[model samples]
Target: MVALIATAFVQTGFAQHDHATHQTQSSALLPLYYNIKDALVVGNASLAAAKAGEFVEALKNADAKIVTGANRDGLLEHSGKIAGSKDLKSQREHFAGLSTDMIALAKGSKLSTEPVYQMYCPMKKTSWLSSEKTVKNPYYGSAMLTCGKVVETIK
Candidate 1:
């Protein structure tokens, strides 16, 4: 039975597991994530750093049981890097990595309560999440605002 269960788990791609059907606690991440993204969109380094710090704190306290293995670890790692940086450039650079992990977590854990849009910038080859479908390029802020497209919508 143990072997059978393990085999079933292997047959179903673990990272692609449908979390919308399961109960998870990582929705706690959305508000801080959106705030950090907004701060970066306006090119506010200090606010971004503060938001990132809160992001990490909320992540630590989040009931992340739905997120397993490397996904959870990568999220924490990237969030930590963002929290440690006060420079907008550095924070934005690290934010891409954090967004990557966050996207994976959102998809795999279905932790988002409302709709989340996955936006991408072909110019920078980076993607970020947004609460709305409208394009808001956090990577470049007003310098190149609306520079990206919505690639996916997580419901």
Candidate 2:
């Protein structure tokens, strides 16, 4: 009985350690994600595309244990689309999908020490993750810069 209890405790410790490692690994993607979002907010298609490409590479290089298979694939697909396109419209469209997957992932896992805001744009009918509480619409850029509201905050 003592041996069994010892084994269980050891397993629990490993589980906790794995979870902490996963959180750290997952949080690494947030900066890259923010880079793409910032590029979009400025209406810079070339920069957005470049950032998206970097994001794709980061996603691919991320620890596989950090994200579920479906979520990772969704991220890869949307970011890949954005990376392959230089048109602002196309990049923004793909960003919507990428944001969806990112929001889901961020919601499930602790992505940062600070609160991460999930903003919603009624005009675009889409949501995105932001490190800031202030709204800066990436979909319409400066045209509707402050067009969204914080729908949720992931701490």
Candidate 3:
């Protein structure tokens, strides 16, 4: 996933975008991943060195899962994308866990999480991605995570 995310980052220069369903398990949905990866590029401007590395690592892992297609308990291994028709549990878990992590990061940054929000819903049984959101991620020292959504899935 790190490879895919890194590749996307290299090409897009730090913006999140759907690079077509790479794995057989993918989504036709608008891949709206948190734009916080750009924040990771902030390069210790606000976050500590360790924190920055941790953030990057977390993002890389998530991206890797999406690209590689893990399993039922995994992100990209088994069968699921933003709009996956199966494995919604892991998808939701992935984003929810990410949300939890982001919230904690925001708290540490002395940001107001109250204004922060995330949209996650199941589509049948597959993956669940973010969509049409307007929450500012005060944690990344920027409002990068203000919009997102996953839209399609393979049956």
Of the candidates numbered 1 and 3, which has the greater TM-score value? 1
C-alpha RMSD for every candidate: 7.2, 2.9, 18.6
Q: Give the TM-score of candidate 2.
A: 0.86
- TM-score on alpha carbons, each prediction: 0.80, 0.86, 0.23
Tell me the lDDT of candidate 2.
Answer: 0.92
For model 1, how big is the CA root-mean-square deviation?
7.2
Which candidate wins on TM-score? 2
Candidate 1 has which clashing residue pairs, if any? none
Worst 10 residues of 3 by lDDT: 23-32
* Model 2 worst lDDT run, 10 consecutive residues: 18-27
User: What digit string (tens of lDDT, one per residue) describes model 2 on residues 1-155?
Assistant: 99999999999999999888777778888988999999999999899889999888878877887777999999999999988998999999999999999998998888899999999999999999999999999999999999999999899
lDDT of 1 by residue, 1-155 (tens): 99999988886865455443234447768778899899999999888888889988877766556656787688778778777878888888888998998898778766666888999999889899999888888899999999999999998
